[model samples]
Target: MLKFEKVSLTFKTEGREQHVLKDLSYTFETGRITAITGVSGIGKTTILNLAAGLLETSEGSVINTFAKTAYVFQEPRLLPWKTALENVTCVCGDEKKAKFYLDILLPEGSDKYPDELSGGMQQRVSIARAMAYDAELVLLDEALKGLDMQTKDAVVKTLREHLKGRTAIMITHDKSELEFCDTVLEISDAPISELKHVNR
Candidate 1:
């Protein structure tokens, strides 16, 4: 389980203090998929970073109990020198498990390097790497942004299967993605003050 107790995050930019989160309190239950949707630059990704312990809160506290967490960023963030299969295997050190996810996400490009694959294909490889890791919590930041509709549907289905019985949070601009999640959090305002649960 992950809990944010009046968490606040502030960044210093060019001698100005920018507050991203302000006295925000929320709980992400265990073994559930939560989808976060909001306008651009509203600090949705910052929440994920805080959950993953990649960023520290300026005030308050973040309580995360999950032993392992995997994050798929907006970019593929793959190694240019490693093949798709290698990238996936690098996390879990299991080629068989890596191949299994790659076969589902990037079947044809498993042997290809990051530079050789298209943007969508590279993103798929990145997703496969996270899936292969089998972490207790998964964080996705616009993970399906560039895929075609058909491909996006297929990848979402695959993710749904892999994410079962795990805690997952994703930030997406697409409304259709909300239907697959157990909970949808809609955030607004420049400095996010609250997270509202959107009724499905």
Candidate 2:
């Protein structure tokens, strides 16, 4: 299980401190998919970074027990010089597994570089990379922003199958994506309460 205990996050920009999360506490249960939802710029991505240990919280602690982890950023974040298959294989070092995921997510562009694919195709490659990493905990930040409904359904189905017994936390504005989640969390402002959790 991954946990955030009384965590507070603040960032400094131009000598000014910005408080993103204040005394927040939440738990992402094991073997469940959680969707973090809110209006744009409500510090949703900050929570993911905090959980992933990519950023430090100003106070309290984050507890993670998972051995392997994967993260898919809002941007594709693929190496511009690498092909789609290479991006996934580079992480897991399993060419066959990478090919399997790419076949599901990017069947048409396995050999294509990031620069050679469209924005949506590149995003799919990133998704395939994360899925093929075989991580117990997967963190996705706006990971499905650019795909159409058919592709989104395919990718979501692939993710569901790949994440059967693992944990996934996604930051997204799309409500339809909640169908794949067992829980939903919405950040609430005005007095700054912890995230509102709903079980599906």
Quantify all predictions' global Cα lDDT against the true fold.
0.92, 0.87
Q: Can you write out model 2's per-residue Cα lDDT over 13-93, one digit (the tens) per residue?
A: 999988888888888889998898888877888888877888987898989889988999999999988899999999889
Q: How well does candidate 2 score on lDDT at residue 117?
A: 95
User: Best-fitting candidate, measured by TM-score?
Assistant: 1
| Candidate 1 lDDT tens digits, 85-104 | 99999998999999999999
Candidates' TM-scores? 0.97, 0.95
The weakest ten consecutive residues by lDDT in model 1 span 188-197
**Stretches of model 2 off by over 4 angstroms after superposition:** 190-193
Q: How many backbone clashes are present in model 2? A: 0
State each candidate's clash count.
0, 0
Model 1 scores a C-alpha lDDT of 0.92
